[model samples]
Target: MIAVLFRWDIKAGSEQLFKEGWSEIVHLNIEKHGALGSRLFKSKDGEWISYSKWISEDHFYNARKSLDNTEQARIKMAQAIIRAYDPIVMIPVIDHLMATETTHINQLS
Candidate 1:
């Protein structure tokens, strides 16, 4: 699995619009392609971050291609929300032995 993290520092008073636009973009990605899923989060300091999980790097690249006519345009759109944005892709190394049983604990809760 691959995870893509997008960090945005939105301008003051533009949070709502930024979120609305980002939500639309996320919906379009999931609807048009088979993205695993995505989540949006906000920091205590007001920075917005988005994490999207994909089955493979190909899926991520393909979805991004389908979103805009050119790679530059897509990047420009992503950077529009903030003065500076950083995107990172990482592959996690999971250790099943150290993992907890979430299903059982959730049932009890």
Candidate 2:
């Protein structure tokens, strides 16, 4: 599998809009593009980030060539953001994540 990281710096008061758009896009990816799904995060500096997985780098690039049902969501996200960065590709050297009910950040404590 391959990992790709994405980041967006949003305009003030646009958090909900951004999230809604992101959710729409990601669901489409999982349903039609063979994505393994992604985890969303907010950086300490406030950028929105997502780490997504794909079966291969080719899958990621292929997925980007089409945006069949994500037009409105893409518009919302584009309007909400001040900046969007190019996706960062990564190679996996380890797999240490564990599955559990407490896997999320809020459940860590």
Q: Which one is best on TM-score?
A: 2
Could you say which candidate leads in lDDT? 2
State each model's CA lDDT, in order.
0.68, 0.87
- Model 1 misplaced regions, further than 4 Å: 68-80, 95-109
Q: What is the model-wide C-alpha lDDT for candidate 1? A: 0.68
1-109 per-residue lDDT for model 1 (tens digits): 7889988787777665665666666766677666667777788987778888787888788886784434443444455576547678878787253433444642342
Judge candidate 2 at residue 102 and give its lDDT. 30
Worst 10 residues of 1 by lDDT: 100-109
Q: Tell me how far the alpha carbon of residue 31 in candidate 2 is from the true structure, in angstroms, after superposition.
A: 0.6
Q: Poorest 10 consecutive residues of model 2 by lDDT?
A: 100-109
Total clashing pairs in model 2 = 0
Give per-residue CA lDDT, model 2, range 1-109, as digits (tens): 9899999899999988888888898888888888887888998999889999998888888888987888999999999999999999998999897754534663442
